[model samples]
Target: MKINVPFSIAIAVLSAIIALLGYFIENSLLNQIRSSLLQSAIILAGVALIIGVINMMRVHWVEMRGGKGNKIYHLTFFAGLILTLLLGGWFGMSNPNGYWLYEAVVVPVEASLMAIMAIFLTYLLTKIINRRKDFFSIVFLVTVLVGLLTSAPFLGQEIPFIATGNSIVKSLLHLVSNGAMRGILIGVALGSIATGLRVILGSDRPYGG
Candidate 1:
């Protein structure tokens, strides 16, 4: 069974109403509703993540058992996940400086992964510049120039425009981050309403599945 248009429309309307109510009223009821909804959403997401972790373990466990691919890669993924959980869980999330487990284990793994990307990025930049030297190459060149100018003190003293450019860059960064986040939130809101409607109408059939 599929969700009917009528139910989807109803859910959209209800979500809109809730949003409006929260915006205008700012009452205890609305506050409670929002808090409860947030808590429930977080819990549900946590459960989903747990399921994902289990699935990852199961898939890789099979691969390891079957001796598929490089044993190094398989062992790396398994060890990394287990170590992260143990370090974060046992020592607490903050890790408290000098604990060393997080820095020693997690930091090195993260650095190793990030360091490999430099090779891929070099190839990508070469291809991009070769194909679209007119537009993309200029954009990439300008980005690197701005990055260097802002980070280095030498350019800032000689060129006042560098300081002004830094401010402009900061503003643009803020606008991009805020706009992208808002877009994501809006998409999530619509998706949530659709999922809620499907569950209510029994079309999703979580119980049956």
Candidate 2:
């Protein structure tokens, strides 16, 4: 594929300038320009998402018309999707009926899926222990057990030691999860900066056709 060097460099330079202005400038005009650009980006994203969903629905509808084996699943998906959209459109999402629909239908479905995932994860852990009697396997099993036990309701109320253990587990979990999330975000930001610099230098041409 041939690279559109000029176009790519232009895009990268413009993006860098806009980003710098947004971050460093305190002028009202600059701030308004930044806000407008952000809003335009958001609007574009929303339109893209809608188009993607419509395309997905169209593909599924075609599959259903073709009498595929998964037609029933596709039908159910479209039915649920259309019903949810209709309800939300007719009555605002905050309306009693819409809220009830979400609470009564969506919440239970999501909860049921989560419950199933917990069972599946437990099964996988047991399988791993049975298959591998290694130190890491033991540690994994112990960690899973500790997490489950600490999070269990009512057990901490009855036992003082369990309450203390739960508090420690919660603290450790929060610290580890937050640290990992921050590391991931930092990595992403750095990667984006590198890519933008590459494009601006005309070393990379993502817009090539």
Candidate 3:
């Protein structure tokens, strides 16, 4: 069926009104509404997290039993996840005593794994710059080099040229990043409003089907 334009407009207006009210008003009623929505969202997220963990465990368990020797790695991963979750749930994530488990164990392991990605990205960058052989590649390489040089703690403040180069690069980067981010946020907000209205209007019955 064709979308009911009038209905859509009414829903959009209602959403805008509610958002404006929440933004402008600082009263008990608005506070309650805001708190209720925040809490409901948190609860929904928790449920989604639980579902995700269960699905991951199930998939990995199957792989362990029926798939391959690489399955041992999956089993080890799930074991670690479960141990971490249990410890955090029981003792609290912010427990300073157990912080070592997160900082020392988790941080180094994850950082090393992620650092491998940088190597692959560097290889990809080399291939890309080699093939492109144009102003875009040169521009991209210069941007990356300037960013890296500025970020390096030792060279950052010491180098005279780094300051000027960093300023120019940062301005360009910020303009592009912020503009893209704003566009994405607008699209996401519109999509969220549309989905919420659809659910409220009984047009999307996820729980039913």
User: What lDDT tens digits, residue by residue, belong to model 3 across residues 134-190?
Assistant: 998887787787676665645446445554545665677778879989999999999
TM-score, per-candidate, Cα-based: 0.54, 0.69, 0.58
Residue 153, model 2, lDDT: 49
Ordered by lDDT, highest first, the candidates read 2, 3, 1
**In candidate 2, which residue pairs get closer than 3 Å at backbone N, Cα or C atoms, i.e. clash?**
none
| Residue pairs whose backbone atoms clash in candidate 1 | none
Stretches off by above 4 angstroms in model 1 are 1-24, 83-100, 111-123, 153-209
What digit string (tens of lDDT, one per residue) describes model 2 on residues 61-170? 88899987687899888988888888888888989876666888889999999999988977887899689979988977877676665666464363344435448666
- Comparing 1 and 2 on lDDT, the stronger one: 2
Compare the candidates by lDDT and give the number of the best one: 2
Against the true structure, whose TM-score is highest? 2
Better of 2 and 3 by TM-score: 2
Return the TM-score for candidate 1, rounded to 2 decimals.
0.54
Candidate 3's C-alpha runs over 4 A off are 1-21, 24-31, 89-100, 131-133, 147-209
What is the alpha-carbon RMSD of candidate 1 to the true structure? Answer: 7.0
After aligning candidate 2 to the native by TM-score, how far in Å is the CA of 189 from where it should be?
Answer: 5.6
